[model samples]
Target: MSAAETAAETAAETATRRTPGLVPVGETLRSAERGPRQPAADPGTPPARMPWSFWRLLGSELGLTFRRPRNLLMLAALGVVPIVIGVALRVVAAEDGMGGIIEDVAGNSLMLTFVSFSFLVLLFMPVVVSVVAGDSIAGEAGAGTLRYLLAAPSGRTRLLAVKYVNAVVFAYAVTAAVALPALATGLVLFPAGDVTLLSGTTISMGDGLLRIVIAVGYVGAGMAALAAVALAMSTFTEVSIGAIAATIVLIIVCQVLRAIPELGSITPYLLPTRFTNFDAVLRSPIDTAAMGEGLLAFGAYILLFGSIAWARFSGKDITS
Candidate 1:
C-alpha cells in the first residue's frame, strides 16, 4: 500500500476504537439527550436536615385541637360546670335548705369558686386532659398521619416533645376555662369579698384572688402529670379512645385505692392522693409543704412517662 493510504487506514482504526463498540453513536446521542440522572440515594446516608420550629408545631397542634367540635364541646362543658354551680348556690342561699353543701354563698362568693374548683379538679380536669393528651399520638397513628409526620424532617423526639408540650398547654387552658367562668359567675351572680379560710381565719379580697390563682395553677400542674402519662399511653396504642379510656380508668383505680382504708399505707403515693392539696393555699398562711410535695410528684411522673414516649416514638416503625 502507498504511505498515504496506510496513514488513512491507521486514522480510521483509531477513530473506530475511540467510539463505543457495543452501543451505537445514535444511542449515545439519545442518552445525552436525556438530562443528567441523579445518583441513587445511599440507604445509609442520613436525610437532609430540616429546620424544626417548635412554635410552628405547637401552633398547628393547638389549632387542630381547639377547632375540633368534640374538643370544643368538652371545653364548653367544663365552662358550664361553674355556671351551674353558681346558679344552684344562688338559689340554695335563698331557700336556706342545703346547709352542709355550702355554708355561706351569700356572705363569701369566693367559697363558691373554691367549691367549683374542687369538683372540677377531681374529674373534669382529668377528663379534659385525657381528650387532648390521649389523642396526641394514637389519633395520629390511627388516622394514618403518623407515618407522614415522621417522614418530615423533624426528629421523632422533637415531635414527641411538641405533642407533650401541647398537651400540657391544653391542660392549663382547660383549667383556666373552668376557673375564669367560675370567677365571672361568682362576681356577677354572687357578691365577691374577703374569703373565709377553712382554718377559721379571713383573707382580704385581693389576697383571696391571688390564692385562687395559685389554686388554679396547682390544679393545672396536677393534671399535667396525668397528661404526660396519657401521652405515653397514646404512644403504645393506635386507638385514641382506648388511650383516653385507659387514662380515666387509671384515675379511677388510683382514686379507689386512695379511698380504701386498708391501702392507706400505699395510697399516699397514688396520683390522686394530694390532688386537693391545693386547698392548702386557702389557709391563712399558705401550706407550701403540701403543695411542694404534690408538685414534685407531678414533675417526677412527667419525666418518667415523657422519657418512655420519646424512646417509643424515636424507634417506632412507620408502617402506617
Candidate 2:
C-alpha cells in the first residue's frame, strides 16, 4: 500500500480505540461502556456516624411510658389515696377523738403527708415502680418493637441507659403523685403550723416544708433503686407481668423478713427497711448518719442491678 493509505488506516484504528461504546481489541464491551470504577473504601475508615441524638430517644421513651392508660391510672390511684387518708383521719377525729399517731396526723397536714408516705412507700409505690420498670424492656420485646429500636442508630448500651432513666423519671413522678396531693389535702383539711418532730421538737412551717422536700427526694432514690431491679428482671423475660410480679413478691418477702424479730440481723439490708428511713428526716437535728446509710444502700443496689441489666441486654439476641 502507498504511505498515505497506510497512515490513513492507522488513524482509523486509533479513532476506534478512543470511541465510546466501542470495545478496544483486548477489552470487553461492558468495561469500555462503564468506564473506570470507583476505588474501594479504606479498610481503616470509620463508619458514617448516625445523627440521632440520645435525648430524643430518651424523650420518646418517657412519652410512651407516661402516656399509657394503665400508668396514668396508677398515678391517679397514688394521688387519691392521700386524699382518702386525710378525709378518713378527719372523720375519725370528729367521731371519736384520735390519739397518738392519729391525733398528730389529724392536727397537722405535714404529719398527714408523712403518714401517707409511710403507708404507700412500702407496697403501693413499689408496685407502681415495678409496673413501669418491668414493662420497659419486656413490653417492647413482647410487642416486637424492641428489635426495631435496636436496629436504629441507638446502641444497646445507650438504649438501656435511656430505659433506666425513663424509669427513674417515672419513680419521681410517683413520689410527687403521693406528695403533692397529700400536702394539698392536709393544708385544706388540717391546720398548718410548726411541725412537731417525732422527737417532740417543734420546727417552723418553712423548715417542715423543706423536710418534706428532702423526704420526697429520699423516697424517690429508693424507688429508683427498685426500678433498677425491675429493669434487670425485665431483660430476663419477655413477659412484663412476670417481671412485675416477681419484683413485688421479692419486696413482700423482704418485708416479711423485716417483720421477724429473729431476722433482725438481715433487716437493715432489706430494701423495704430503707424505704421508711425517711423518718430520719422527721428527727430534731435530722439523723444524717441513718439517712446516709439508707442512701448508700440505695446506691449499692442500683449499681449491682444496673450492671446485671447491662450485661444481659447488651449480649442478648433481639428475636422480637
Candidate 3:
C-alpha cells in the first residue's frame, strides 16, 4: 500500500480499537444535532381530555326526569287544576247566577286565566319549583347516583351549571303546564273576546293572548329564581324530602312575613312578593315598571342563591 493509504488505515484501526462497539463520532454528532426521538407513545396511555357538552348532559338529565313517575304525576296534577276550576265556576254560574265581578268575568276566557294564575302563582308554581329543585342534587345523592355522575368526564362546575339549567327549564315547563291547561279550559268553557284590562281599557283578543304568554314567561322567570334558592338548599342536604320541606318552610316564612303590615318595607324584597306581580300584564299601558322590578328582584335572587349553590357544590365531597 502507499504511505498515505497505510497511515489512514492505521488511524482507522486505532479509532475502532479505542472505541469498541461505540457509535462513530459523526453518527453521535448527527444524533445530538437532531431533535429528540420522543419515546414511542405508550399505546396504553389515555388520550387528551375534552370537556363534556352541557347540552348533552342537560338532555340526559331531562330524559331521566321525564321517565320518573313522580314527575309525570306532578304534571298531571298541575293539568287538573284548571279543569277543576272551570267545572266549579261553571256550576256556580249555572246555579247561583253570575253577578257583580263574577258577571263581568263570566264569559271572559282571559279572565279565567287571570284568576287561575292568581291562585297558581301563590302556591302551585312555587311548590312545583321546590319539588324539582329539591330533587336536582339531593335526589341524586339520596339515591346514591351522585357518585356515578361525578365519575363522568365533566368537572364539578360544569355539572353544577347543567343542573341549574335543568332546574330553570323545569320551572318553565311547570309554568307552561299551568298556563296551557288554563288557556285551553278557558277557551273551551268561556268565550274568547276582547280582554278588559285592569285599567278598564279593552285590547284585541290577539293582544290579550300575547300578554298571557308574556305573563306565563314572567311567572317562569320568577319560579326559576325560586328554583335557585331551593337548589342551594338542596346541596346542603342529602335527603330530598328534607330539602323540599325546608324550601317550602322557607317560602311559607317569607309569605307570612310579607303579609305582616309592619314589614311592608322589606316585603318588597321577599321572593314570593313579586310572583303575583305578573298581574301587571293586565294593565292598559302594560305597567312595565312593576314587571321590571319583579324581574330585577328575581335576577338578584338567582345570582345570590346560584352563587351559594356553586360554592357549596364545588367543595362537596361525593361519597355517594
Task: Give the Cα lDDT of each candidate.
Answer: 0.81, 0.88, 0.82
The residue-by-residue lDDT of candidate 3 on 85-123, one tens digit each, is 876786777756567545545668877777788888877
Clashing pairs in 1: none
For candidate 1, lDDT tens digit of each residue in 1-320? Answer: 99999999999988778432233323333342442466778999875443446678778988998788988898889899999999988877787466654665566767767788788887778988998899999999889887666545455666788898889888988888888898888888877778778787888889988998998899889889999989999998989999999999999998888878998999868888878899898786899999999999999989998888877766565545
Best by TM-score: 2
The segments of candidate 2 whose C-alpha lies over 4 angstroms from its true place after superposition are: 1-52, 95-97
The lDDT leader among the candidates is 2
Worst lDDT run of 10 residues, candidate 3, spans 20-29
Q: Per-residue lDDT of 25-94 in model 2, one digit per residue for the tens?
A: 2332233233346577799987444435678888898898888999999999999999999999888888
After TM-score superposition, what is the CA distance of residue 187 in candidate 1 from its true location, in Å? 1.0
TM-score of each: 0.82, 0.84, 0.82
- Misplaced by over 4 Å in model 3 are 1-52, 95-97
